[model samples]
Target chain A: MRTFFNTQMEVLNSELIKMGSLCEEMIELSIKALQEHQDFYKEILKLETQLDRQERNIQDLCMQILLQQQPVAGDLRKVYSALKIISDMERIGDMALDIAKIIKESPLEYQERLENMASATVEMVHLSIDCFIKQDLSIAHSVTQKDDVVDKLFYQIKQDVIAGLSKNSQESEVFINYLMIAKYFEKIADHSTNIAEWVEYSITGNYVGEEE
Target chain B: MRTFFNTQMEVLNSELIKMGSLCEEMIELSIKALQEHQDFYKEILKLETQLDRQERNIQDLCMQILLQQQPVAGDLRKVYSALKIISDMERIGDMALDIAKIIKESPLEYQERLENMASATVEMVHLSIDCFIKQDLSIAHSVTQKDDVVDKLFYQIKQDVIAGLSKNSQESEVFINYLMIAKYFEKIADHSTNIAEWVEYSITGNYVGEEE
Candidate 1:
């Protein structure tokens, strides 16, 4: 029984790592899609569907682990964290997919700051997953600091958009699209912050979702 | 043991119903805030915080129940459903709060259709919770239908905002704010649809998030 439980636990960990990697790939693909403001729907949609399947798979694994045998406190926390973190990660995928679909027909005037913001948000996703993989609180805490950079960049971009809005329908439309894309990136970072909190909770038995 | 488990389940059911009511109240208050275009921050903030606390309380109760006793298939589903539903509900609260904060300093041109959309979205929230309270799959199914109404309104408003953008910064800003607020209402409806799906899963043991 002990060996069987340990093996299942390892499977759970491995599956989450895979899902986390999928999230990173989706972010990268989304940024690439954003750079050209082109249609990457076929590839991006495949990743989004994979994300949903991955979430369901991990969900089933968690329920199986919980139902077959009673896990101790540590094992229980791990399962619970996987169950919670996948939703955040899945939302990250969905939002990135949303970013991909933005202004596909008519490419907007993309800002360099917007690309930097996406890069910053992507780093936060990477670090949060690494924290889960390595079980490191310091890495988990670092994701929070990185969120500050993303937020600052978002505000700057938002100010520029608001200030630059004009009576020209085409020009303002481009500005609005950029604003929406920036908000999506900001939200992606927020979801990463959520994963970091869940990682901290799984390791320490405490949760404080400090990202508002 | 069975009797104790049943009692705990009753407690769980009652707490969820309460949380569901808080969700309803938050939606209603947010709509009222939107119609008057006033800052309902204090009351809305209180409800949002209560939502977070309610989520934490229910989460603790779920972990307690899961840890203390071994539930069978049905009771286990009940716990899992509650765990999933609360996150969707809390997000509904958060999104409603986001709607409340839109264009507070500048009162935009209000659309009566937007109010109707908010009303329809609020009804969806009420009925989704009712499905959980009564374990009614029909009510759960109804939520999917209501989502169509919300979506239609959102698209109409989106088109109007897009077409109405002009060279005046103030004029287009209002339209953009209206667009953002409409999107928030659409998202609140989406979260309700998520709850409906969870309720369906809890009852029929099948999950289909068909609203998307």
Candidate 2:
């Protein structure tokens, strides 16, 4: 019975890690498609369907483990964490998809500031998934701190857009589109931070996001 | 033994439902304070600490149940679902607190259109929480359809802000503030949609948030 339970727990943990990898890949590929202005967004969109399917799959697997194995104590926490992490990962995937679609539809010229912000977000996503997969509390802690970096980048982009609006009204429409895209990117990183927080919770069994 | 497990499960369920009530009240009061520009902003800030405390209490209780009870299949699912739902509720609380702070620091001189968007979101939050409380699949299903309402409102706000930029640059800061706040409100609704979808999953044990 102990071996069976251990195997089931291992499967659940690996499955969640798989979902985490998918989320990271989608974010990276979507950004590359945008920055390169390639036709690769089609691929990103296709991957989004995979994200949707994987979300349901992970949730189902966690539910099955919780229902069939009747996970106890630490095992139960792992299953619960999988369920929450999957939801956050799914949203992170959606934000990436949204960014990819925006890039695909407009294919606009990228401003330097927007490019920097997008790149910073790409790095943030990479580090976030790394922390999740490694379960490195220090890496997770670093990801939390760098959330301010993404936020600062976002603030700079917003400021540039605001400044642009004052001097050049003709480009403001295009600017707003870029701004929304940047906002979406910031949100993607925010969701990644959320996943990292879940990783912390799974380890500590405490709600670390709140001031407790 | 079964009776002991059932009692623990019951406590977890009821506590989660109570936390849901706090989440609903926070979202509602925060929106009301913003829309009315009343002195309620201060009161809403006070509620944030209370909401955080409630979230901490529930998670601790969930930990106790999982550790001590070793509940079976159905009961374990109930406990795990409570944990997942409370996390969502806590995120919703964060969203509301974020919006309330935005309202306080930068008072909105004009927000009729933004208020309309918030009103739609207010409706969505109520319906979504109700779905969770009642475990009503119909309500949960309806929430998926209405997600686009918040999306549309977000788009409309973005367009209005961009247009306002060109038409009246003087109100640009105000418009941008409104845009960001609207975006936050839309996200709060998105988080609510997440809860409703999870409620669907919990009741039916079917992961069903995928676009179909």
Candidate 3:
């Protein structure tokens, strides 16, 4: 029975890494499409569906573990944390899909700040999952720190968008869209930060991250 | 043991209603503050902390229920759904806080569309909790429908903000803030919709609501 539970736990860990990679790919492909004037909405939508399925699959597995196996206190926290983390992971997919739609509708040339924001957000997503898989406290902290970088870039983009409005109010629609785009990327970072906090909580049994 | 389990489930139900009420109040107060040029930051902040505490309390309670009681499948799903719903409820508070900060920093006069959006979102929050408490399927479906109204008002607000940018680019920051404020309201509705979906899932075992 112990071996059976541990084998199932191994499946859970592998599935999480798979879901996390899907998030990274969707984010990267969406941002790449935006930057390079390519279209990836078709690909992103496919990935989004996959991510959704992943969430449901993981959720069912967690419930099965709870019902079939009597997880100890530490194991219970890990399973519960998995349930929370996957929700955030799925939101990352939604954020990516949102960005893809924005890019598809308005193919604005990618500015440097927006690019920076995208990179930081993607890195945060990457590191968040890494921390969870390895249970590395330091990596989780780094993901939180990366959120500051994403925020700074988002602020710069906001200022630039406002400046663009004065120079050419005709593009006001696009400018406002740019603001929403930056906000979405910032939100992606925020979700990743939440994931990192959950990772910490699973290990330490203390949820230190402030409410998202 | 059966009696004790029922008693604990009752306590869990009451706590969820309390937390849901806190979410509704935070959103209503924050929107009211924006419209009336009053500061509810202090009050809303107080409510937010209380909401946070409620989340932690409810989460611990749910875990206890899972660990101590050998809940049947139905009871298990209810406990799991509570775990998922409280996260969304806390996000409603976070969205309210985001809107409150924008109002405090910029103090934009509320427009009718934003007002409509706010009202729809608040009602959605209320209806979501009402539905969950009653386990009414009709109310859950109505909550999903209300999301459309909030989305429409958000679109109108987006249009207005972009138009405002043309008239006075100097106030672009505030205009963009209005855009974000509307998005936050839309997001509050989205979270409420998620809550409604969880309610449906708990009752029917079919998770119909799409990813957030």
TM-score against native, each model = 0.95, 0.88, 0.97
Which parts of model 2 are misplaced by more than 4 Å? B38-42, B70-74
Q: Candidate 1 clashing pairs?
A: A167-B166, A167-B167, A167-B168
Query: Each candidate: what lDDT?
Result: 0.83, 0.74, 0.90
TM-score, model 1 to reference: 0.95
**lDDT tens readout by residue for model 2, B81-170:** 676667677777877877787778677754677777777777777888788778799998787778898798788878778787888775
lDDT of 3 at A42: 90
Query: Which candidate number would show the highest DockQ if scored against the true structure?
Result: 3
Please state the CAPRI-style docking class of candidate 3: medium
Ranking by DockQ: 3, 1, 2
- Candidate 3 scores an fnat of 0.53
The digit string of per-residue lDDT tens for model 1 on B1-212 reads: 56887888888999999999998998888777777777786788898888899888888888888888767577777888898888888888887777776745556656788888888999999999999999999999999899999999988986667667654566765776788888888888988998999899888878787222
- Candidate RMSDs in Å, in order, are 2.0, 3.1, 1.3
DockQ of candidates 1 onward, in order? 0.44, 0.39, 0.65
Give the DockQ (C-alpha) for candidate 3.
0.65
**Tens digits of lDDT, candidate 1, A71-188:** 8687888888888898888888988787787756557756799989988999999999999999999999999889989989988987677667663566766777788889888889
State which candidate, 1 or 3, has the greater TM-score: 3
Note the residue pairs that clash in candidate 3: none
Place model 2 in a CAPRI quality band: acceptable
